[model samples]
Every structure is written in structure tokens, then in C-alpha cells.
Target: MKAFFLDAAVTLTLTAAITTMAACVGPGAEAGTVTKGKIYASEAAMDAPLYLYENNHAEEGGKTFSRSRYSDPQGKALVEEEVIYEAGKLKQHTYVQHQTEERGTIDVNDGKVYYVFINAKGTKTGSDKWNDDMLLPDMLGQRIADNWELLNAGENLKVRFLALEVQDNFGFKIFKEGESTFQGKPVVDLAMKATGFFVALAAPSFKFAVEKEAPHRLLKMDGRL
Candidate 1:
């Protein structure tokens, strides 16, 4: 299956992985910047959250570390993920699905991406060489930040993204959609779509709301996650 971070192309089960990755903060992590957010079914119907997530970020020994936990509305942990970055890029990621006891890890080494998953079915492993512009899910925000100017200038940004399920990389594009208000705050709307010929035909586009000012914090996202 094709996956582009928070894009709707991913299956519902993969949404858990997407949220786990997005909740990760980039390098220059701080200890007290923990934040919590709710995942709702839709923007208009916010009566209750389908799931709640918590993010804790920290810096240790020159590496940025992030831990994210997702829970049901009744407060039972569903999935938990830990991610580490070195020099502002993803180093390794591990996640656990509490209910199924399924666990997996993604590692980058010597220009290659490695994945290992364990479940009742058995242990599965896969690897593929990655390009310099290839991004792990946690790096999506930083990528957007790095290309902020181009996006604001109405330029389409293209990059490769790692799809953990397939243990492969796929091309995707990001561009500015327009400007709008989200949660009463001024924001810029951005859209992401798969760029590969076949994937593009089937993959659904995704939307994001980012703060208009400097730092350009992401205010909201609308996708399968």
C-alpha cells in the first residue's frame, strides 16, 4: 500500500503509525514542550475525539528524542512510538500496538532504510537504499519548514517519502493551497499528493494548516490520521 505520512492513501491501521510520526518534534528539542491534542472525526463535528495523543520531546547527548502515545477516549493506550533524530534527520523509530502486540522499527544506515516488524504472523524484514531527499514521516514538518519560502511563492515542492508498510520510498509533492483561518488563528493551507504516475492516480490528497507567522507551526491537519 502507498503511504504519504498523513495522506488519505494510507489504510486506517496505518493511520496509527502516521499520527505517531507527526507527533514527533524535530531537532533542537526541549524538555518541557510536551503537548496534547485530540483527533476528531471531522473539523465541523468536534463533539468528541476518536483518539487522544500526547507528545514528549527531549534532547540527550546531541540527539533529539520524542515519545508519543495514543489512547482511546476512555484512556486506554492503543499505540506508543519512540523516535530519535541525529543532526536533524531521522535515526531510528520504534512503535508498539498495544492491542495486537505488534511492534516494528525503522532504521536508517549507510544510506539505506531498514524495517523490521514482529507479530503473531512472524518476523518480517525489508531494506532499500534511500536518496538524500527521502524523508521519514517525522521529518515531514521540518521538510515543510525548510521549503516555506518556495511554498509561499506558489512553488510545488517534490520529495521522496518512506512508506514503512512497504519499506520503500515514493515521490510526493507539496504546495500551497491558499490562506485561511483555523481555530480562529490566521494560517496557510498546504496540500500534499503522491507524484508517482500510478500512485498519483489512486492516492488521495491531504491538507494542512500552518501558522502564517515565523516558525510556521502546524495548527491542524485533515487526513486519514
Candidate 2:
């Protein structure tokens, strides 16, 4: 597979991962034998679940999506993010809040990644090209590989695998706070500190819950940005 890196001039650091609620459905879904539009639980002991499989949206060559509304210190709508994916690849990602608005696409082929950025007005602004020498030659799959390596190296589970959408001059400090239950399933809690040059002096924090199984899906996530 082709291996590429961010151009040296681009010094931004960002990490990305899917955050969603897990719901088990379909026949034999409890045993991870998914059929049709269902998510099956895995019985295997997974250090980290495969990214390709974790994506409920990518499962059918269709779109899986989520959206969030951000609020200001005064509890007013400030920004919003609508994350979209198709067959495990990010098809369209949009973030509009405050004065910052961006829309972009992430594409990976044969180990090479192409990141194209467009402004809110729908004009191409910049693009990045890179390669990964790990896993399947796809963006989401490569992230799963990277995250597994980090987990094996004892990296904190709080720090999620980087996604192309969020890779721009930012630092993530993740803390594993404790354990909890989501939808009656066991989960681990992670607190994230997002800090970067473009971010304000007061960095925002977010919370995440990960399933305690092989795939370690994001059971639920809630935060105020």
C-alpha cells in the first residue's frame, strides 16, 4: 500500500472517531451474527473492534449519519456539525458554527488518502494527500489499525483514532474517568480536552462512552462545545 504523510508545512494535529449509540437488532444479533439492518454483539475478546465493522452506516454501501447542535456560553446556538458516511468512507462532513464553516470529503484508495476542503460558500480552499502503510487501503479501516496499535502500546483508550475530518492543528488529551452503563450495556467513560492554536483560550471538553467488547463501539456521546 502507498504510504503518505501530511505535507511538512501542515502542522495541525487532529483525531477523529465515530460516536453513536449502539442498538442490537435482527436475528442472532446478540451473537454478533448480523443480518439485514441489525447490529450484532461480538462474543470475541477484542482489544479494539474493527473500524470497518464498527461503522453501522458503511455496512450497506449507504449513508450512516449523525448531527449535533452546539451552544454558546449563554445557551444559544453557536454551531452545528452534520457528519455523514457511506460504506465506511466519509462522504460529506459539514461544520457550521460561529464564524467557522467548512465542508469536506475524505477518500482513500490503495493506501493513499486524499483530503479536500471547501469553504461555506462551496469553493475549494485547500487539499492534502497522504498514505498509510497499515490495514486495508481505506480511511476508516486504517484508523482502526492505528487505534489498535495505540491500544497495544498502552495508549489511553480515551484518545480516539484520528479522522480526516478533524485533522487540523488540534491536540486531544483523553482521560479514562470510569465505567458506566448505557442502554443497560457496560461502557467506559472518556473525558476529552480539545486544545489547539485555532481554539479559544478555554478549551472545550467532551465525554464519550465505549462498549466493553471486541469492537468497542461508541455507545453514546454527549458534550457541549
Candidate 3:
């Protein structure tokens, strides 16, 4: 079966990255300045639309943590998450289910990346050594932004990340449906379809209500299949 877990690739991996090297904010230095907020999936039919929360450093602008939750068709609660760049070159990931957790930790050694995964019982389940194909979420946004030419030209853009070699990366132009209100603010209705390698078979279409501004932060997403 093509598992529902594949949806997580769209949810978490959208923000994937090899955690960047940066100095940890000191306690006396704007430590609690993390801005936190949640964005919801905008589809009306979805009673359990995807909900995501991100904690971003107010001073640094990069995400510190991101969590997303949605219910599968079988009514099982699922969450996929990432904790980034805590102190050293370490990042944490968790995939949650009704009773089990698939957890992973990523670390760098001699400029090579590897990850270790464990089950809910705290037993080491698997590990990948010198893995080159790990998906980094941080690059996904920039990948779309860097291809503004194609986006503007109304092209079906093929997105590629060197580190995510095995994933299917594709995006399509979403016509402006109209104007709408989201979170008490005005937004533009734009639609796009995206499929990562893991969820390529699903080929989900996403609707976005974006701030009609220069750096449009997504106001809402309709990520229903």
C-alpha cells in the first residue's frame, strides 16, 4: 500500500534543509523572541485539514521548530515534525502515530550526513551511513522562489535539489481564483499541485491564500487530495 505517511514528505520536507551552522542565541540575548504561529489547510470539506505550527527566531529568521498534524483516512492522528539546529550540527525528526513513533536524528561527520532512526520503544531500528539523498526542507521554498521566471511565465516547473536526488519534485501554475479573507486579512487565491518522491502517486493539489505583498507568507492552504 502507498502509505499515508508519504504525505509527511509534503508537510515536513517542504521545509527541509541540512541544518545550517549558526551560533545559538544566548540566554541574555533575545532568547525568547521566537515568533510562533499556525497555518491551516483551507479546504471546506476537510474536517481534519492539515495544521502546522512553526517557531522562528525573531532575530535570525530561520525556523527553530516546525510541527504539522493531520488525520489519516482511517481516523488515525498523525504528526510529522522537525527540530532544527539546536546547538551543534544536530536536528531531530519525529513521525507519530496512534501507538508508535518513528524518530530520527541527523548529524554531520567530516562534512558527510547520516541519520539514525529509533522506534517508540527506544530501540535503534535503523541507520543510514553517509547518506547523500537526505531531503533538506529549507531548500524547498528557495527552490520555488529561485524559479520565479518559470513561475511568472506560467510554466509547469520541475523542481530539483541536488541532495534530494531520488525524489520527484514538480510544481504547476495555480491560476488566481479570486480574492478572499484569511485570518482577518485579505488574501489572493492561488492554487498549485505538488508531489514529492514519496507521495508522487497521490499527486495532491494544494490551494493557497497568500498575502498580496512582496514576500507573500502563505495565509492558508487547502492540501486535500
**What C-alpha lDDT do the candidate models reach, one value each?**
0.70, 0.38, 0.38
All candidates: CA RMSD in angstroms? 5.8, 14.2, 9.7
Q: Give the TM-score of candidate 2.
A: 0.41
lDDT (10s digit) by residue, model 2, range 1-225: 111111111111112222222121111112222211111122132233212112112223345453434343244544444445445444454555354655555454544445556656555433334322211112322243336445434465332222434442234555567778866778666665654544424446655565655455444444432
Model 3, position 52, has a per-residue lDDT of 30
* Runs with alpha carbons beyond 4 Å of true place in candidate 1: 1-21
| Per-residue C-alpha lDDT of model 1 across residues 167-224, encoded as one tens digit per residue | 6678888899999987577888998888888776656666777778867766565554
The Cα error of candidate 1 at residue 149, in Å, is 1.1
Better of 1 and 3 by lDDT: 1
Lowest-sum lDDT 10-residue window in model 2:
1-10
| Model 2 / residue 91 / CA error / Å | 8.9
Q: Which stretches of candidate 3 lie over 4 Å from their true place?
A: 1-81, 85-99, 107-113, 120-146, 160-198
TM-score of 1: 0.83
Clashes of 3: 10
Return the top candidate by lDDT. Answer: 1
Residue 5 lDDT in model 3?
Answer: 12
